[model samples]
Target: MSKNIVIIGASRGIGKELVQLFANNEGNHIIALSRNVEAMSEFDHLKNVTYKAFDLSSSTVLEDLTQILSEIKSVDILINNAGKLVNKPFLELTKADIESCYQTNAIGVMLSTQVVVPKMLNKGGHIVNISTMGAFQGSVKFPGLSAYSTSKAGLVSFTELFAEEFKETKIKMNCLCLGAVQTEMLEEAFPGFQAPLSAKSMALYIHDFALNGHKYMNGKILPVSLSTP
Candidate 1:
């Protein structure tokens, strides 16, 4: 059956790859949401795909969602990949930066999923939260990664908690703790940090995950890294 998929933070990175991957499949209807729709212009030529640009932090998220969703009947999958991270020393990190990270990475994901999960209840759905591998092992010494790691950690927790809340539903939840990827976010966060996974490879992983990972993967944090060992 054709599936309606909602992808938040779809302008770039893993989200962008998902837009491309899902678009390749004829049965998928994709809704790509980001703060700037222009970033997704590459997919403009594709059919069965729609775009929405809005600040997830804005108070109008619910209202904006209602308007957009009123036109669509349902979504079979929700990918919360929108996130912000600031790499700075604990002392140098500003209150605004910390709060912004939490809001975007953790709170924004929670609120956005809340808007979509109910629509999926009648027909079991999958919710994939894009997190970071930094949350897996302690990164206190990873240089200026305090805020980033913490927010991802919070996201992992949120995924576990939310999964428990839906015990009665066929819907499932999982966290994709992605490792370094060649994305603007990586460049901006690590400047010159080299990654083993290219955006294309990352996108492929997302496609496979959505197609098969959700079947036996719920309430778990899955890591995607470059190392072969």
Candidate 2:
């Protein structure tokens, strides 16, 4: 059956690849959200893909999202791939840095999911939150990810609690603690660090997970990486 899938942060990297992968299926209807929608205009010709410009951290996020959701009516899957990474030493990080990271990575996911849950409550749905291995306690520590990792840890905890709170409703929620992937975000955060997984490759795995994960997975923090962590 065709599904209505909403992908946030769809302008580049994994989110962009996901839009391409889903659009190729033809049966799926995709709504791509990004801060700069113009970057996604290349996909405008595809009938299955619709693009929207919105910032996750904006004060008007809920209002903007509600307007978008109104057109779709129901959402089958929500991919919270939007994130902000501030690469600064712990001592150098400011209050603004931490707040910005939390706002975009943790709070944004909460607000967005809240808006979509009611629509998915009756029909059942899946939510895939994009997280990083940095959030893992045992993972190799990077020097400049204090705010980024802390914010992601908050999201991990939020996903766990949200799953329990809505378990009876059959809305599956999972966090994918991903390893380093070759993307613009990674390059910006760690210049010249080569990750084993490419955005396209990782997107393939995420594609399957988003479509079928609800069948057996809920509240699971699954790691997708080659390194031991």
Candidate 3:
């Protein structure tokens, strides 16, 4: 059976690898969405994969996504992997920095889900939110990640709340707070730091989880990391 899978932030890093992993199955139709359409050209050869320009930070996120959602028959799985990282000192952060982080990492994800929820309403689906270990309670914190981590924390809350709200239905939601992964995004936040895992390795795990994790858990916030607490 072919499943309709949507992967946001599909231009590079873990999201890009995720598209590759899922598309490898051949039976899965992968919808790759991101603000950078040109960066997604690598997926052009995959017959089962499609790319679109999606800006989560835009004020019209809901409207834009609503239009996209209508063209799809149903979404079997949705991976909210988009994020914004502003590595400014707490005092130096500007309003734009804060807003962009929250909009892309948190609020935008919520509104995007609002548009896609209808597609999953009948047959049900899984929504996996990708967050950061910085947002995990009692975890070690970073000095310049106040805005980034706080915004991701909002996603942590959304996963739990959305799961509880839709418990009676077949829909399920969960959050994964990741540690350091070797990627462009990591370099922006932690320059010269070598993460224990690569984006391809992390995406491998997420690919499997998005398919089966819902059977065992809902509203669960699991930490996927090699970092110490």
Cα deviation of 197, candidate 3, in Å: 0.1
Cα RMSD for predicted model 1: 1.8
Lowest-sum lDDT 10-residue window in model 1? 134-143
Q: Report lDDT (CA) for all predictions.
A: 0.83, 0.91, 0.94
User: Each candidate: RMSD to true structure?
Assistant: 1.8, 0.9, 0.7
Candidate 3 runs further than 4 Å off: none
Using lDDT as the measure, which candidate wins? 3
Report the C-alpha lDDT of model 3 over 1-229, residue by residue, as the tens digit.
Answer: 6799999999999999999999988999999999999999999999999899999999899999877766798999999999999999999999999999999999999999998888999999999999999999999997999999999999999999999899999999999999999999989777899999999999999999999999999999999999646
When 1 and 2 are scored with lDDT, the better candidate is: 2
The full ranking of all candidates by lDDT, starting with the best, is 3, 2, 1
- Measured with C-alpha atoms, the lDDT of residue 13 in candidate 1 is 83
Model 2 lDDT per residue over 34-146, tens place? 99878999788889999999788889888889998897778899999988999998999999999999989999889999899988988999999999899976888788998
Stretches of candidate 1 off by over 4 Å are: 137-141, 227-229
